[model samples]
Target chain A: MLAMRELSVGFAGGLALRRATLSVARGERLGVAGESGSGKTMLGLACLGMLPEVAVVTGSVRFDGGELVGAAERDLRRLRGQRIAMVFQEPLSALNPLRRVGELIAEPLRLHRGLSRAAALDRACALLSEVGLPDPASRLRQYPHEMSGGQRQRVTIALALACDPDLLIADEPTTALDVQVAAHILALLRALSESRRMALILISHDLRAIAAVTDRLAVLYGGDIIEEGPTADVLAAPRHPYTQGLIAARPTLSARRDRNAPLPTIPGTVPALAHLPPGCRFAGRCPVELPVCRSTRPAGNPACHRGGP
Target chain B: MLLSVEQVHRSYRMPRRRMFRAPPVIAAVQGLSLTVAQGEVLGIVGESGSGKSTLARLVMGFERPDQGRVLLNGQEAHRLPAAARRQTQMVFQDPSDSLDPRRSIGWSITEPLLAMGLRAAERHARAADLLARVGLAPADMHRYPHEFSGGQRQRIAIARAISPDPALLVADEPVAALDVSVQAQVLNLLLELNLTLGLAMLFISHDLAVVASIADRIAVMHHGRIIETGPTARIVSAPAHPYTQALFAAA
Candidate 1:
């Protein structure tokens, strides 16, 4: 159970995430989809109290009736591995090259659960098996570099599940993997969340990845959550102009498109953070922007002037 | 055919793990053959370790295949002189890495022209013209790569790739590093270039949907071999191979 009320993350350049309110219930899978610089990653980091030192975070983040915003580093550290574990996009960098896979998974268990080395390692082996890794016993002794990208990602997932976290924040978890491997990872995440009753926040720029695993979706644009609804509903009939543009932009297998025709693309690139308009972040690039959109902020779940595209 | 790769085979030796053991060789490309006609967009779809990039290198004459031949304009690509090799230009995945951040965009775009012995005046004129062609302002020529966004930098990369007026363009995941919305823009630019310039492209990507959007023909690669090759529509509609079917399902 987590609730974020008007949370904003800002740097010297500008606010990267602005007045965003979101919540996730137990065992819920929430997908945060956005382009680069859309602040999807920042929102995930803010939940774990893992923002950069220079980031100025504002508003409230409540988890399990505990306020995480402005909590002490020690308090955050205690909750991190035990309650809210994260899986990053780059699995290789997340894992230590020098450490064996078993040790990596076992350390978190030992630290958080106070298990003996042998007991922790045994639990680690079980976790490896739980995440569907083959030969869990043998995989424990191998280094991160010894495994393939997909295997390394599985190991990382095992490490995250070591302490049986209540929430898992996977930021572009499958971004670096191949298509088939990516599908496997997404399936694994969905299965894990359902079986373990863990809340998952899957952040990615790819709409297809989001569409595959998440039931609820939040579309971020230039640091703001412009649209939030059922993933299927939002994808099928997006109300916001920016959301429409994003859905249209993605190449789809279902569509029989003319090969010579150009894809439907948003008119302009995302403006620099410092140069973003005070109103809607998608204003300048939006296809049907009213004059008021340029100077005034639009509000609502879809966050638009004339909704229902 | 504008370009043909004939039974190409390439391999690399793996590091030996034990003493007194011969290092094992890893086959990256194995007896792979394909052809791209003039102005045709040939999409190569494959996962990592599938040797798609190795094929690009072989086609570009950057590396000689251990066996078979890579022929460009009916000539051995690896044996072609530097001047002749200029007919092929490449656009890489990450524009930031491919571009020199310190250099002005104009200078980088015109570097290929320099290699072809173009005078300074003509190079500048061509660079300005190329920037406009890619949908960037002519004034952006003076701006450095760091000044632009990822999408804009890719537009600059495209401008550079086309400056030489190459007969064939080898784009290895050109839009992979870009955002979804921005990826569409770049893909559109590539499509426009293909239509207007009649530039044959070796479009390589892991995204089946993206390949489907741009390519006239699609080749599905697995374990360093072409498992399926057909018209793009046919490949997407009714894939013959199970691997291709699985790939489509995954995408």
Candidate 2:
């Protein structure tokens, strides 16, 4: 359904993503995991053809057998909502406060499906119900602020699903929500994707959330995908030192440690894009850094020399 | 006990629609009571609107309870004199907002010391010492808050909070605004402070895993009430309350 080859995004100071490549088969669920400044969001934007004008993008982004890197704006717009929908991290800001939620959900139907206002609203109510919202009709008349955070997110998902896109790109969908509510939303996304057989790209800094929903996981660091494989396999024995540090740093509920003991952490912070090192960006912080890693950049999938699953 | 809250009930009156109508009352903290001994860390875990922040405010004496009392060192926290009230200090979630942008880092760190009648030279010396203890250079005291990264700003905030040498440190989601790697750095700092300084801490956060990692005892709050309170090991291993079980499951 989607193929990205050697995609790189360059800004004034430095490149955000470098030679990043990925592909997603129809109905496949892929997760992109990385910390801040890892260019996870940039990759998502590239897939949607939503990179800002200032961003100098290279290489190809193919969707449904059509090239998207240099596609016309009109064609991209048609593909954006109708074939490739996206749900963002912040639901409150993504929605319009002045507009009633029902109308907002119906807007996509009107634009993509060209339905009348009444028919679009009816479909909107149905979509809301399909997303497991209670009293869907009354909710349609309520504004975004009137609903709770979880409900607002549900409405956002309803908007994204209104057009029945083939692929759904949910970037940190539950970052701003409460734990239980986030769990419910993740469950909703998983169930909807399974039922609809829609391809999904779940991007987040959280490994547990990704583990819960995605089948394949890609570990991104400093604009490079350090590791990529089956989620369970990669998590069970993370190959790259960077990926290992990330998993170790998370405080898990099941693993009780001494309260006074310090958690294992990556030594240094993520380097700024402009000040990236000569070779592996993670070489500065890797626990088992090789001398060769400083001068030679590892290429291909699972971009690490030390270990493999 | 270093800090004790006894049957505290805090409520706020909602805005009235008409002149004749009485406003509705929303109970932010309802009959909540907990204690923290010297050198102990208490974690209060709750979601948004679950009344955890209200409890923090009540403990810090920022808000007076409608019913019951908040006692620090056996004295009523709300009725304590200014000098006595300084025994407690708090670390907020967002360091960028909590630290004053207009002032230098040194000046901001010494504001509490100034209130304690310390001289400018002594305050600066103490601030320098604190800055070093929190893993920053004394030279950084001259820089502005914006010059530092998110993790460095949090370090500065922690230094400021500990400069007062308060008996209890109320850290409300101190690492929530930080990245994962930076979060470990800050959490390790807090744990080190708790050990070295023997400072009692009220560590409040919504992330169960994070709270479980640092806190000796944990309290699960929901709808303005602490539904469960026990040792962290027991709480994580076998949560008795349904809400706690659900929270663990969700986590």
Best by DockQ: 1
Ten-residue region with minimum lDDT total, candidate 2 chain B: B78-87
What stretches of model 2 exceed 4 Å from their correct place?
A: A307-309, B18-20
Q: Is the docking of candidate 2 incorrect, acceptable, medium or high quality?
A: high
Residue range with the least summed lDDT across 10 consecutive positions in model 2 chain A: A300-309
* Candidate 1 per-residue lDDT over residues A69-146, each given as its tens digit: 999999999999899999999999999999999999999888888999999999999999999999999999999999
Give per-residue CA lDDT, model 2, range A1-309, as digits (tens).
Answer: 899999999999798998888999988999999998999999999989999899999999999999999899999999988999999999999999999999999998998899999999999999999999999999999999999999999999999999999999999999999999999999999999999999999999999899999999999998988899999988888888888889989888888987757988777678878877768878888878789889988875568656544
The positional error of residue B193 in candidate 1, measured at the CA in angstroms, is: 0.9
**lDDT of candidates 1 onward, in order:** 0.93, 0.91
lDDT (10s digit) by residue, model 1, range B1-251: 78999999999999997799999999999999999999999999999999999999999999999999999999999899988898999999999987888899999999988978999999889988999999999998999998999999999998998988899999999999998889999999999999999999999999999999999999999999999999998998999999999998898
Residue A294, candidate 1: C-alpha displacement in angstroms:
1.2
**Number of clashing residue pairs in every model?**
0, 0
lDDT of 1 at A266: 88
Runs of candidate 1 with Cα error greater than 4 angstroms are: none
Candidate 1: deviation at residue A276, Å?
0.7
